[model samples]
Target: MTGPHALKPFLLAFPGPLRDRLVAAVLSGEKTATTGLLLEYEAEKEELPEVGERSALIDSDGREVAVVEITEVQVLPLRDADLRLALAEGEGYRSVAEWRAGHENFWHGEEMREALGDPGFVVDGDTMLVVEWFRVVEVLREA
Candidate 1:
């Protein structure tokens, strides 16, 4: 597995606004109950090899926002099952189906999809990457 040090550069180079938008869209819902709408953003700032920065912000509803934190917009070699498993474990879900159900419900099902627009996609072989962007306000954690 790659260490945080190895990933730190990539994470730091990610775009902030993009990360915020995605986090807002993903975290906005009753089921999810995210502390902030601002999550993390990532995007490509130029045609150069790798260029960008990661940022955190907050939304109007007083939520934390992640902005422009993604440098590479390509797909990672993780399957849907793997992604689901990782999300479940990270989000403290018992199963993939449970996580999916929560997402669907929290995202307001298909209706919400129409409002948010179609999902982004960057497919490479079996890998897939999604890109997005948005602005956000920052939130400070309690000591």
Candidate 2:
């Protein structure tokens, strides 16, 4: 899956079931956006994707599923994420509170806590997040 001629690769956003469900959502045109760590993950890796960048969406197994173009990129605090952003997330969250609750759980999960080496990791208004809006440019059908 890694070669000059191979399709470009981008993370599937989440892991396991969440990733699968979200990918399916994107394919079905229900999801148009995603969010991720701006500092700890992107900046740390020096791989912050820019607006207008196109990427091959990959599954948990590292298989390319689709290609998407980033339409918008917003660096904002977790507290600044409003219902508009949640709606763009395409998760059917009715309100920002609901979205925040769900994301707080994800960010505080055992895996993330261990990865960040901060068991007390918490999502606050100041927590920076890279919210990316995307559109599916092409769906790579399995061969």
Candidate 3:
């Protein structure tokens, strides 16, 4: 049933460190074009999912950091006629519950809390900040 607000949430979950790196790249303007970064990351994937896909995150050096599972891929075709046709044909209905359920299985069920608690080292110019335990819950992407 499509309505005024018929959009699903898309999560771009990444490893805590990799997320931080991307955030830094954004803030620093080093990676001015975010789309390029996404493309680069996407290219590194060895395989794609059959249904709604997920990806394994890689660091700047192309090393595996974590896995990113796209639980849902809601297509909102802008053309009203197209959308209407899609809705009428039952083409947009997809169960995301199974995909959502797999998140726990990724990374040993390590919640964001646990990732933050691990030791982290941050360097700022000549100064360095070594945090024994840090807690951060920052949204990477939502669309």
Q: List clash counts for every candidate, in order.
A: 34, 0, 0
lDDT of 2 by residue, 1-143 (tens): 35775645666545688888788888888888888767566535756678888888888776788888999888898878988888877788999999888788888888777777788877788999988899998888631
lDDT of 3 by residue, 1-143 (tens): 13664322212236466445553443333321111111222334522222333333334444433333433222221211122222222212233333222322332234432444423322122321111111112223321
In order, what lDDT does every prediction score? 0.33, 0.79, 0.29
In order of appearance, the predictions have TM-scores of: 0.33, 0.88, 0.22
A best-first ranking of the candidates according to their TM-score comes to: 2, 1, 3
Task: Please provide, for model 1 over 37-77, each residue's C-alpha lDDT reduced to its tens digit, 9 standing for 90 to 100.
Answer: 01112232223223343444334443333332333333232
Per-model root-mean-square deviation over C-alphas:
11.7, 2.2, 20.8
lDDT of 1: 0.33
> Higher TM-score: candidate 2 or 3?
2
TM-score of 3: 0.22
| Residue 84 C-alpha lDDT in model 1 | 38
lDDT of 1 at 114: 44
Stretches > 4 Å off in candidate 1: 1-52, 59-79, 83-85, 88-90, 108-111, 117-139
